[model samples]
Target: MRTIDRRPLALAGCLFLAALCLAPQTAHAHLVQTGFGTFYDGVAHLFITPPDLLVAIGLGLLAGLCGAAASRSVVFALPAAWLAGEMAGAFFPSSLALPWLTTVSFGAVGVLVALNANLPRALLVALACGAGLLHGFVNGSTMVAAGTDRLGMIGASVSVFLVITLASGLVVSLRAHWAQVAVRVAGSWIAAIGLLMLGWLVRGQG
Candidate 1:
């Protein structure tokens, strides 16, 4: 019997291409904060710079996408990203993150990874949380370092997480039926995006 193939991977290339078509626009708006909060910080493959709050919330949503892809549980990923971002922020100016936020963020990720994860969920959340943390933390660090005033710094941090969650969540929420293929495709796409951002970060440093 022919089974219903739930994978959008068959069209991964097409989707990727389509995504690329829109990438130029997304590139205009990136997670990495750039010089003094006023730059694109572009790269051919990667992108980074200090982000506005909209970007942070979008990232949180992206985490949800990863979680959904990994375990079909979008619910877990959003919070995971939020906790991780906040936790990482608490770490600013030091190796050690704020004790409470750090512990809680890591703990939340761990708990969800242990409990919410299943066959697919385990891998998905793991991947999502890992990437999410890196992006979130760096963004947090940037804000802490860049802003001139304490209020400005706090504002930046909030912008980072708030935007990521908002954007990612908005994107994921639209794809309601929970199609495995769609979710997996989203996970793959977002992961690729992360790699691109990382590349941008490296290039900026270089």
Candidate 2:
């Protein structure tokens, strides 16, 4: 008799729960003037935005699938790359093409997760860095007009780092086959969303 793997199924459920529980919609285009302001605002922005949160979580899950070395790479690369992008966005002019870059990141990561791929460590690190940059660039551009660039960048980077770490840690802790399947399913969902977003972008352009 052969043993069945339920870990993948369980992992899928876990991913969905994380996405639903932690994600919501926020006005990413403008800074929230009320509440704590600045630094806290950046943190709040990430928690409240579904798209941003989804992609970040996806990246974490993908890293976890690759094992500890990959997970560690993401932890090191993502935040640092994001902070660098934020700095560039603050100091330099913004690009209209930048927002779409995140969609590309989301789509690419989602595909990798759905496939359960075993990519090289170097490639994974590079991908993580790229996603981080796109996410950070958007964050910085949004707050740049308000003069809270420094605090907001710090807050956003910290919040994102913690979120990715937690998600990846949770995924990596699971060793069952069903959990792995579930993660793949979750990845499919992310990819679908990214595809829809990409379509919308094309329509707007045309």
Candidate 3:
């Protein structure tokens, strides 16, 4: 057998080791860095997080189904409640993790949307506020753990406002019965996803 060239193999191994040493360390999984600041990172976080996005979409769809007044109320109330909850959470950090709360929240909102339930304005606002508080607390705790600035929370709340405004506004403008039905169909899909996630969670726990 021909003798192997040990020099090339040694060089390759050395380069690989060097590369590993130079590699950047892993960042926090929950926080996204946009190179623009913590604020933009917070803004991006809402879009990237599935549970939060689903809740926002469910709330928006429900508000839209109810009408313009409900949409307007949710548009403002959700973000405000989110900010308040974030502030509270930041002041008093907790180790409690309630992933199930998010699943239930989005699931219930989806059910209401699919049913086309004629929820009163006050009730709709209350639902939006409740969801906001729960999600906001989670986000706040996450931010604190990551050592992110509070401005990120403000950015996240702003993003919530934008998302709700867009989603609810689009639904409110729909006049056709079929179009409304389509919205309800989307709600059903959201509910289905929530159920699937809940099942997975249960399975994992078991």
Candidate 4:
């Protein structure tokens, strides 16, 4: 483990704390919360207009940055990967069973990323696939709930996020100076955010 300055780490820690404290109030960006994902009506509008797309892009970048801060460079791919995995799962029949799968899939991919964050971008694409599956499952179910077209909306959202994530990934990849260290620093932050998300998700269920 390359030991760097504690000052930066400490600074990052404070920011993480702030984000965690404020996250509860600010998580909803355009996407309305119909309570838990399981409780959502199927036809929720994703706000695909320019403003919404811009929001998605911004959030997608934020998610990537957060992931990179949390786990390392591996974290960089997480948001896109998770989004892809979750969304792909929507193509199939989604139910209460899907959330457990989403959790497990994310946990598994996270472990892999933690272990080999520097692996080629190609593998990162695979991670995105798994993420899309989970995303799709929940989305499809939501569409189903509201009697909306599942495949069409899922495709649109996936395209939007994919482009956003890919652009974010490129930005990270291009800044190759001390990239490993960068990944580690970013991964920790992303993990912090993920933990908060997990907590909120758990609370919603309870």
lDDT for each of the candidates?
Answer: 0.41, 0.78, 0.85, 0.44
RMSD per prediction, one decimal?
Answer: 14.3, 12.5, 16.4, 12.8
Task: Score residue 68 of candidate 1 by CA lDDT.
Answer: 38
Ten contiguous residues minimizing lDDT sum, candidate 3: 20-29
Off by over 4 Å in 4: 1-92, 103-116, 120-122, 161-166, 176-184, 197-206
Highest TM-score: give the candidate number: 3
**Model 3 global lDDT (CA atoms, 0 to 1):** 0.85
Question: Candidate 1 local accuracy as lDDT?
Answer: 0.41
lDDT of 2 by residue, 1-206 (tens): 99999999999998885554333233246666547878898888787766668778888999899888889988878888888888887887363334455676788789999999887888988988888887777777766865675988888888889988997898899889999899999999999888888677656541
Worst 10 residues of 4 by lDDT: 22-31
lDDT of 4 by residue, 1-206 (tens): 99777998899998886554333221112334445452232223434322223333333333343444322333334344434543454455444433333443444443443343444445554555445544454554545444444444544454545555564565455456566445444434444445554565557641
TM-score order of candidates, top first: 3, 2, 4, 1
**Candidate 3 runs further than 4 Å off:** 1-29
Candidate 4, lDDT over the whole model = 0.44
* Reference-based lDDT, residue 60, model 1: 45
Q: Mark the regions of model 2 whose C-alpha exceeds 4 Å error after superposition.
A: 1-28, 95-97
**Candidate 1 lowest-lDDT run of ten:** 38-47
Model 1 residue 112 distance off true place after TM-score fit, in angstroms? 13
